[model samples]
Target: MSGAGNGFPVPDERQLDLERLDLERLARLRAQLVAHDCAAGLFYDPTNIRYATGTSNMQVYGLHNPCRYVFVPAEGPTVLFDFAGCAHLSAGRSAVGEVRPAVSWYHFIVGERVAEKAALWAEEIAELMARHGGGERRLAVDRLDPAGLRALEARGIAVADGQEVANQARKIKTPQEVLAVRAAVDGCETAIGRMAAALAPGITEQALWSHLHQANIELGGEWIETRLLTSGPRTNPWYQECSGRVIEAGDIVAFDTDLIGLHGYSADLSRTWVAGERPAGDAQRRLYAAAFEQVTRNIPLFRPGVSFGEIAARAQRPPERYRGLPGAALAHGIGLCNEYPLIVDPSAWEAGGVEGRVEAGMVFCVEAFAGEPGGREGVKLEQQILVTETGPELLSARLDETLL
Candidate 1:
């Protein structure tokens, strides 16, 4: 636990406030939409809807069903299109100007189902736009079924991809958002500490993994976003999900706690530890040392106004022996989920890389990995950060370097 300390001077749990949404964030979204020239925004992605409207109901269900959505006019108030009969919930919890019943998939019977629903939805959307002085103006959408898109077009509303605008709005953290993310990371660190105290040989990866999940649930976390917990050979190539394979002595156990925790923000941190009480063998120490170096070396480079591509160019590679292991980007933005401005290897910069200059209030995860290509084990490490007016602040706590 050396290089990166907690991103903020976190208060104890009893004194900490974890509420995530506020009028300020919603205001920021409206401003971004206007700047993008989006007369109004129609958001169907569950996360986008949550960001724009500050309401949640059966979110995972809504993700695939499209039963719930949000409509935000750039210059006026926000509106939520929740499932029928659920307006009260939105009214109770959201800052929206109005709550309207949307066509839930449950109501589709058979004949002309999509057409009927789309027409109904379009009518409401058009009325809302017209009320906001945006008659026949552009409607940016994050996700919409083809039937709905065509219906909006038929209704004379221009539809375009609004995901980037949503990302831009959410990229910078409000003060409350920062506090909420801090609380999430605190919950995550507590869960990880529990796992470390309970670490031992013969524990199944499933059982070890459940400790974090249980702790997160108890701490008011919404969900565990990934299943990446593994040990031994499964740890080398990366992305191997947790299995029933029993951890053995001297094995290296690694996991990315991609947990969606308090206030619906994410705490995405990774750690690798040696199984059992004994000290690591030579190979374990070698890989772990390399990973530690790669992670710690880059934390200072994420200052305000720094270029993401420049950081990518200077990113430390896996120690020479582990050069070619398959892995994702070295790092990416984290909020409700891995959001934007992915920092990748410089070699891939020209091939669809997202370029941007880091700014104060931007949160990023710095990642590093080490393994012999096609070898038995590897190490993965990541640290959450907040780029500030001064410099980068480490949001995540220090890892147990002794285990590595």
Candidate 2:
């Protein structure tokens, strides 16, 4: 959209080869299918479908309505079952080979005939496996209705965890994927600048949050995953969606830009700032400093070859007063969406932690939240990082100096 004033150069779309990206992503998914020993992958989740085929149509709508899906064979052509009459959408895409009308079996669509539709859907899938599965009946499916699963099982098809295959495939970013991520972050930060410039006393939280949405849409970005902008006391307990509460002078406005930017990549970054020109008070500064330190301290621990547990063990904790509240993750992988390898605090690691190693091509968002127990204010800070062979590279480099 506008010039890159956020230090990172604006991504040149000319440099992005969509066909190459599609091929690379398809190869990655196939590799994962081979590793998982599945003959094919049946992707119903729109994100996984986009990853495997690079063809998108009504992504959010496709999420809940299983009206669209793709059949990706481990060693054959990709067949897209598009929404009725929407097969034209995948035309000219090298990643997609055949396009057919989808058989939707969701309750909203088929009502009492769900079983009938699911049977039809399963038959086609079984036929595809017979034709291209090389005698393997195992299929990896990301998401499916219970009826659909039962119907497939009736046909002797074995289903495996397809989400795992998709996640593992999406974990390592190709060089082109990294470039796409850079473009997304650049667009997201530009939108963040717009939102920040609009912050002032008397502005409703919803109104302020809309600036980020408007700027993202104007820049060809898709959608924001959450409305996380909050001000004043609302910022204390995190995860409060933006509302009509009018911001006051010196109020702390904290938000996470779970922005899905250009090319369907995500730029999940967060920041907190004081509302008005009135300088931040002592409590505000202390919260901001702690949150800032937590993010900055944890970022360096994310070099290649490090274990997820090691990162959590060595992560910097907030002051004792602020330790009562913790965000969902200390660091998590970022790709098409917040995908895998959710690193958490040591206290909660036993339950929510994942087993994984930091690879050079992976990207992550290091997170921090500092809000004293019963305090009126809090600070949320996050940074997007790309793991290099040597160490972490800060992708979201424009931190608020005034608040810091």
TM-score of 1: 0.93
Misplaced by over 4 Å in model 1 are: 1-20, 105-112
Candidate 1 lDDT tens digits, 158-179: 8877898899999998887887
Local lDDT at 31 for model 1: 84
Clashing pairs for model 2 are none
Following a full C-alpha superposition, what root-mean-square deviation does model 1 have from the true structure? 3.7
User: Candidate 1: how many backbone clashes?
Assistant: 2
Lowest-sum lDDT 10-residue window in model 1 = 1-10
TM-score of 2: 0.97
TM-score of each: 0.93, 0.97
Q: In order, what lDDT does every prediction score? A: 0.81, 0.90
Question: Which candidate wins on TM-score?
Answer: 2
Instruction: Please tell me which predicted candidate would have the highest lDDT against the true structure.
Output: 2
Q: Which residue pairs in candidate 1 have backbone atoms (N, alpha carbon, C) closer than 3 angstroms, thus clashing?
A: 7-394, 7-395
Give one digit per residue, the lDDT tens place, for model 2 in 1-404.
23565543354566788888898999999999999999999999999889988988998888778879999999989999999998888888889989999888899988899999899999999999999999999999999879999999999999999999999999999988988898899888878878878899999999999998887887788989998999999998899899999999999999999998889999999989898899999899999989888888889999999999899889998888898875647989999999897898888989988778999999999998999878998899999999999999998865776765
